[model samples]
Target chain A: MAYLILKDLLLQRNMMLLAFAYVLLFAFAFQSMGDEGQLVAIISMVGYMFVMVGGAWEEKNNSDTLWNSMPAPKWKIVGAKYLAIPVYVAFVTLVYAVVSSAISLLQIPITTAPINVFVAALGTIGVFVAASLYYPVYFAFGYTKSRYWHFILIFGIVALSSMLPNLFPEKPAWIDPLFEKLPKLTGDAMFLVVAICFVALLVAVSFLLSLRFYGRREF
Target chain B: MESILELRNVVKNFTGFKINGISFSLEPGYIMGFIGANGSGKTTTIKLIMNLLHLEMGEIKVFGLDSRQHEQQIKQRIGFVYDDNHFYEELTITQMTKVLAPFYKKWDWNTYNRYIHRFGLPSNKKIKTFSRGMKMKYALAVALSHKAELLIMDEPTSGLDPIVRSEILDILSEVILDERCSVLFSSHITSDLDRIADYVTLIHNGTILFSTSKEELFEKYSLVKGERSLLGENLRPYLVGYRESQFGFEGLVTDKAAVQAMLNGNALLERPTLEDIMLYCTRGRAV
Candidate 1:
């Protein structure tokens, strides 16, 4: 299993410089959104880029035939993609830190976020959400077909994020009660446990769906 | 003893192509040459056996176990090499092997390194830098190093030069010396099989023409050449397929003795190679 993840990392090794460039790009683009938004954008965009590139490598190499012909099971192949998500997340986080540190040391005018467990957790969750939606399509239809959905998802998020303020000029009445209850919920450590469990459950369900879809796929 | 591999009434369908109830089996300790024209379902059948494609009907058995139900177990013992290089091109063979070696229960690094050294493959070079023959040799090295009992190769020698092809064939011949290993080598290059195959299975139009021993195949079919004037109505039944020209005529004949007797020293009867057999059986024009 680790080998499978390592394979993706090795394949992506040449792109490390490109990945650093992407970090700088995303940092520049999201600078106006302040630290949290910039951090989340860098983590999710760069992390998801890894996932897409990994899938592309499989298609380009036509490697499903290789893996399926061997003793490796479908579940392991599907599971490895999900497992690698966090690794990608960790990598992007590290890159963001280096870039942020360099900006700080050099007194660059770029706005940067501090690395904290909470913000990093949010970024990781963001990646999980995107991957959960994207992978099922990828496994069902392969990379070539699923890539359109990836574009749509990205566009939809951008469109929705921009439209949300317009759609609700004022906060909904229900959000007020929920926001009030959120502080009390956060006061207890149980909320963190529940949130982690929720993300885990989402990932587990996505993994199962991907496994089922990939199981029926023919190389 | 159970056959090393078996397929009974296996059927698969695509939009315009189908493998129509194909059946053949290979025993242990031998090489079975799967010969077919392009798009004749050789690769599809191989994929079916490897469970890379879902079987629309019938059964595939490897080592007496159901292929789908026992896929992992069966695959552990089966090594495969396809025509195209499927390993990651960006990574060196050393890195690629590190990722794949753990999946096979019996993977032997010593055997792998031995084959690599023997094949003269560079360990540190990315696969993209390797020549077609080197890529194929790397694939073969991985396939052989796992202690595989069944080696399923689809067009492994298709695009290689004669020297490299000969090298692969030699390794295949040596691998079969174990007496426990069997090979199903699929190729359009019939000459490779002529030198190494113990059994030959011919497929045409998604159907199995015949699956028999090489000696039996040679005995059953003969290549006949003679004057175009010798072509007659009575001899039409024996000719599988023949072509005529201003100079002479040649064809594959199922009944060599009858054709020889009919021609009466006017025609020459010779043992047909697998290429002749495949060509006549699949593409030859009747009469």
Candidate 2:
């Protein structure tokens, strides 16, 4: 599994450099806008790009057939791919933090927050969820065949999220209390605990689903 | 005899083609040549044995272990080489080795290096820079370095110069000299199999035509050529893939002795080659 992950990393090593350069550019551009939260989005987007690039490289090279022929269980191969998501997210976050810190030390007038671990964790979680949703579908249909489905998924989520509020302009009476109480719950430490558990469960289920799809796939 | 690989009544189906219930086995200390035409299910059968493709029916066992239930364990002892290169093309040979070496328990760096040196492969060169033959040599080096008990190669000699093909055949012969290792090689190049194979399994249109010792196959089939006037109605039933030209008629006959008796000095009977057998059995004229 470690070797498989290492292989993916090596194949996508160029992405790291690209991500670093992108981070530097975005940081410099958004520094004047005074938006620090965009750094998290940048990191998340880079992480997402790594997953797609890795999948594309694998498909182009037909590495899945090679990996399937190796002495590893099919589930382990799929598990390694899922495991790479967090590893990549962490690497992207690290590069962003480093670039942001260098800009701060040079006396640039950027809105540099001191690398909040909580925000980074949240960003990683968000990217992981998105990847988890995408990768299982990618594995099921492969890169070329899954592109339209991926477009549909992204657009469907965007459409649904944007339409829900317009359709229900009058907040339901039952939902107002829950929305009112949500911030109070988020401020409590136990909320972080619950969030972590939920994210972990989602990731676990996603891994199992990807594994099931990958196991049935023929090279 | 200890069987190293066994397939029993194996069946796989696609939309228009099916690998119909084929069964064959290879014993240790010998090479089995899997002979078939293009799209004749050779690669498909190899994929099935590797469990890359799911089996619709029947079972495959490698080293007496079920291919599916114990795939990792079974694969640990098996080495595979495909017709096309399957490694990372952008990575150098050394980098590719680093990625793949740790997967097998018995990988020997010295053995790999020895092959690298012998094959004249540049360690620092990217695979995309290597020619087709060089890539195949690299694949063979990797396959051999793993101390694999069974070597399964699919059309490894397909598109190579004759000299390079001969070199590969020589290396395959050397690999099988270990006595504990066996090879299941598939190719349309029957000449290569003629040089190295001990057992032959011929498949055509998703069916096994014959699986027997190479010597026995030669003994059973004969290439008979005679004057066109001698090809009578009486000999029509015995002729396979009979071809007629302005000068004579030639075809493959299974019962060489009986055919010779019937012809009685009118026809010239020669030992049938693997190519002759494959062509006659698969696409030969019936009468």
Candidate 3:
């Protein structure tokens, strides 16, 4: 499993460098947003993008087939891919923390926190949710066949979020109460525990589904 | 004799093609040549054994262990080389080996470096810059370095100059000299197999035409050439596949003694080469 992750990292070493550069550039551009949470969100998105790039490189070189021929169980191979996501997220987070700290030392008016645990937790969970959704679909259909499905997923979320406000001219019955209690729930320890458990459940289910799909796949 | 690899009633289906009850076995220390025409399920069968493709039905056992049940164990013992290079094209030979070597438990660095040196492969050059033959040599080097007991190569010599093809064949011959190892080689180039194969299995249109000792295949089939007029309706029944031209009629006859008696002094009968057998069996008309 370590070797598999190492292989992907070595293959995408240049891409990782470019991604780090992009994150630094984007952090400065979005500095005026004055919210460390938003910057973390951007960094998280970049981290997740590397997962897709890794899959693309595998498909481009047809190394997936080669990996299948290796002496590793199919499940371990799939698990390695999922495991690499968190590593990427951590690396991205660390780079962002360092860059943001450096910018502050230069007396820039960057509104950066000292690596707030809450924001980091939120960003990690957000990336995990996104990866949990994307990987199972990608594993089931592979990179080439899943491109349209990925687009549809992104477009569906955007379209739904945009249309929901207009669909109910007055606030919806469930939305009003949920938004009213959202501030209290945000600070609740119990709510954070439940959220973590829910995300873990999602990831476990996704991993199992991806394993099933990958085992039966032909080449 | 111990069988190293066995496929029993193996079946696979694509949209329009199917591998119908294909079965063959190879024992220790012998090379089996898998010959077939284009799209004749050679690669599919190899993939099935390697577990690269899922088999629809039937059982495949390597070293007496179920292929699916012991897939990782089986793969660890078997080395595979595909027709096209499957390694990362952008990585240098050194980097590629570093990525692959960790997966094999018995990987020998000395052996790998020896092969690299012998093949004249530059360790630091990227694979994209290597020619087709060099890529194949690199693949072979990797396969050999793993101390693999079974080498399953699919069309390893498909697109190479004759000189390089001969080099590959020579390397295969040396690999076979180790009594603990066996080879299952698939190729359209029958001449390569003819030089090194101990057993020959011919597949045509997803069916096993024949699988037997190489010597027996040659003994069973004879190529007969005769004047066009000499081929009569009575002799037509004996020919497996016959072709007629302006000068003469040439064909494959399975019953060599019977055909010689029938044609007596009217034509020439000689031992059939592997290519002759492949061409006639797949393309020529059968009696």
Query: Which wins on lDDT, candidate 1 or candidate 2?
Result: 1
Query: Which numbered prediction scores highest in DockQ against the true structure?
Result: 1
Interface RMSD of 2: 0.9
How well does candidate 1 match the true structure in TM-score terms?
0.96
The TM-score between candidate 3 and the true structure equals 0.93
Please report, as a value between 0 and 1, the fraction of native contacts recovered by candidate 3: 0.87
Accuracy of chain B in candidate 1 (TM-score): 0.98
Ranking by lDDT: 1, 2, 3
Q: Tell me the tens digit of each residue's lDDT in model 2 across A17-113.
A: 8887877776766565344467666666678888888888888888888988988777877888888988998898789878877877887766655
What ranking emerges by DockQ with the best candidate at the front?
1, 2, 3
Model 2 lDDT tens row, B205-277: 8899889999998888899999999888878888877888899988998788789899999999998888988
- Per-residue lDDT, model 1, residue A43, is 90
Query: What range of 10 consecutive residues in model 2 chain B has the weakest lDDT sum?
Result: B278-287
| Model 1 error, position A169 (Å) | 1.8
* Candidate that would win on lDDT: 1
TM-score for each predicted model, relative to the true structure: 0.96, 0.94, 0.93
Each candidate's DockQ score against the native complex? 0.92, 0.80, 0.75
Interface RMSD of each: 0.5, 0.9, 1.1
Question: How well does candidate 2 score on lDDT at residue A216?
Answer: 91
